[model samples]
Target: MITVITFNPSIDTLYKLETFEIGKVQRAGDVKKSAGGKGINVARVLNQLGHSPMCMGFVGGYNGLYIKDEIKKIGLRDEFIKIDGETRVCLNIIDKNKVSTEILESGPIVEENDMIKFERHLENILEETKILVASGSLPKGLPIDYYGLLGEICRIKNIKFILDTSGKYLESAINSHIYMIKPNIDELEALCKCNINNKEDAIKEAYKLLRYNIENICISMGKDGMILVNKDSIYEIKIPNIKIENTVGSGDSSIAGFAYGLLNDYSLKDCLRLSNACGMSNAMNIKTGFIDVNEIEKLFKEIEVLEYSKI
Candidate 1:
């Protein structure tokens, strides 16, 4: 079974308008809302791909209730621990030209007791989990090394832990025997504290992360495809150009695809191809974290994965 963790989940609200202006009253042409977090997005895509993923996190108050109901509506298992504070609401304002503006709220603080409860809950879940994917940022009142703690546990249990995050949180888990990490180019740059001018540079920077006991590193370059570096080989995946609708959850979708491929024992090349295909498919849809299975199947054959020589 695959388990997903969202340390800070939210209710994602999207507004579509003809155009957005400063200091003016505006009417939205369309609005959509759903349960959202990087982990939730990964689980949503995994479910659409015919996998049932268990989602674990914190939720409370009315908005948390809404998130619970929405997760039930989506047929995902809810193992969320109830907290005292309300879950956050994040907004995305999109205009006719496809530009996006975001206003995100920092989630509620978690108490020490609640943290203990979650750790106990996660421990039980890990017993049966084959792959564990943790995404998004840490909430208030949680230590910076929270993800690292989980990684260490997964390592002891011999479960593959795939992490998607940036900055210090990513740094915290660098030595925890992580199975994989999917970071976009900017996030990769931030983690490495260096500039990546091109694909070769990305590969070079990603290769350095291997010493941390991370087996696979996938660096996503929007529209330009991705570079995957591992101990054995490196792969450069190319995606066919297509009109994009929304790119919000593309990286999470890619992680889901890669996890699914690993579960099925697919080769690294095939895994990267499926990952990019899922990302591209998500970009073609208006809903975040959604993909058409038919589109994925059609795209799988079109993606190009070329092995890169070691630097």
Candidate 2:
């Protein structure tokens, strides 16, 4: 079983408008809401792919209740820790031209006792968990090396830990025996402190991460697909472009796809193929972290995973 841990979860509210002006009253053409956070998105996509992932995180108040109900509605096991503080609400306003303006909340502060409860809960789940995924940012009041602690625990359990986060959190977990990390081009550039102008550059920068003890580094390049690097081989994955509706959660969907492939014992090339297809499929949908299996199947065949060393 795969387990997903989202430290800070939220109710994502999306608004679609013809135009958004600063300091003006604007009417929205459409509105949507869903249970959100990086890890929750991954769990949603995993559930969509027929994987019953155990969703663990902190949630509280009415919005938290909504998240719990939504998780259950989607047939995922809900293991969220109840807290006193309310869950946050993140707003994404998309204009007619497909430009997104975001307003994100810092989320509720988690106390030390909350982390204690979470660790206890996580310990109980590791026996049944094969892959442990910890995504998103740490809520306020938690230490920066929180993910590193989780990685160490997963390391002792022999479970594959796939981390999807950025900045200091990503850096903290680099040497903790992580099985994989999925960072986009911008994040990769920030981490490696170099500009990646092309696929070759992405491959080279990704190689720098191998020394951190990360077994697999998947660098997403948006429309250019992604580059996957391991100790022995490098693969350049290419995906056919389609009409994009919303790009949020595409990375989480990719992580879910790769985790699914790993759980099913797929080859590395096939794993990258599914991962890229899932990300591409997410872009074609309005809902975040969602994909139609038919769409994924179609995109899967179109995805090209080339062994870079042989090119």
Give the number of the best model, judged by lDDT.
1
Please give the range of 10 consecutive residues that has the lowest summed lDDT in model 1.
Answer: 302-311
Clashing pairs in 2: none
Compute the lDDT of residue 52 as modeled in candidate 2: 93
Give the Å shift of residue 243 in candidate 1: 0.4
- Estimate the overall C-alpha local distance difference test score of candidate 2: 0.91
Q: What is the lDDT of candidate 1?
A: 0.91
The TM-score that candidate 2 achieves is: 0.97
Please write out the lDDT profile of model 2 over residues 1-311, one tens digit for every residue: 99999989999999999999999999999999999999999999999999999999899899999999999999999999999999999998989888888889989989889989988988999989999998999999789998998889988999999999999889877889999999888888888888988778888888888898899998888898888898888888888879998898899999999999999999989989888888889888888889889999999999999885622
How many angstroms is residue 34 displaced in model 2 relative to the true structure, after the best TM-score fit? Answer: 0.6
lDDT of each: 0.91, 0.91
Q: Quote model 1's TM-score.
A: 0.98
Candidate 2, position 281, lDDT: 90
TM-score of each: 0.98, 0.97
Query: Candidate 1, which segments miss by more than 4 Å at Cα?
Result: none
